[model samples]
Target: MASMARNPLPGTIRKDGRRAFYVYLSPPLIRELKKAALDEERPAYELVEEAVEALLKSRRIARPATDGVA
Candidate 1:
């Protein structure tokens, strides 16, 4: 039988320069994220990114400006 392991490399970068990485969360956390995404009518990834940006800000790490016109 074939192994069920995922690819060892990070997934491809998108045209917008985003790459896919793995994140593991508990089942309850997953449900909460889905619920918040539905309630806010936004993608779950947006919420996750917002949370991560806040975390980085708390650590005093600066994120690059994402305003258009790159």
Candidate 2:
């Protein structure tokens, strides 16, 4: 979400408290996240939210994308 940090467009932070972002995960990563969610008995979205929250809390500035990946 470096783009969001750099330029928080007016359309971000939707009224329903959602932001639109996309990630292109390698297949193995996708499977791992899914398995983790299932093992923890939680929705995938919740698991992902936790990860994103952790990243935000780390206070690491997101770098710009290179070769179309971040």
Candidate 3:
């Protein structure tokens, strides 16, 4: 059996100094991220990164609740 391979992107930096990969998003999400960055006077990349981190944290916290919800 073959497994999927991991390819790292050029500009991603992992917290532990390891490799990080980039995933493409839909155009609509890109537009929304641009709008958010403009409104908050922050870079679009920073805003997107913050959003992704928050989502990951939320998922980790919600996993236990989901497991009990059978």
Candidate 4:
């Protein structure tokens, strides 16, 4: 079987140097993130960034000391 080439939908992703992806979140997780973000006075994306950074750290992904430092 041959796969057909298709153009990506606008806002789905980009042809530039940025990549975007999606994750399916359960309601409970969504609520948890919202509460935590509120407590920190930060956006949910900031929490997500911290999570990904922690994950990589746990897996021993090498990173510079200043990688997540402000």
For model 1, the local distance difference test gives 0.77
Per-candidate Cα lDDT values, in order, are 0.77, 0.81, 0.72, 0.75
Over 1-70, each residue of candidate 1 has an lDDT whose tens digit, in order, gives: 1332343344556677666757899999999999999999999988998999888776654545467422
- Candidate order by TM-score, decreasing, is 1, 4, 2, 3
RMSD score of candidate 2 (Å): 9.2
**Residue 20 in model 2: lDDT:** 61
Candidate with maximal lDDT: 2
TM value for model 3: 0.52
- TM-scores for the candidates: 0.66, 0.55, 0.52, 0.58
* Model 4 clash number: 0
Superior by TM-score: candidate 3 or candidate 4: 4
**Candidate 2, run of 10 with poorest lDDT:** 57-66
State the lDDT at 30 in candidate 4. 96
Between which residue pairs do clashes occur in model 4? Answer: none
Instruction: Give candidate 3's error at residue 37 in angstroms.
Output: 0.6
- Tens-place lDDT digits, model 4, residues 1-70: 1232255456755565345556999999999999999999998877997899898886664654556762
Error of 4 at 47 (Å): 0.5
List model 2 lDDT by residue over 2-52, tens digit each.
786777788877797877676799999999999999999998778998998
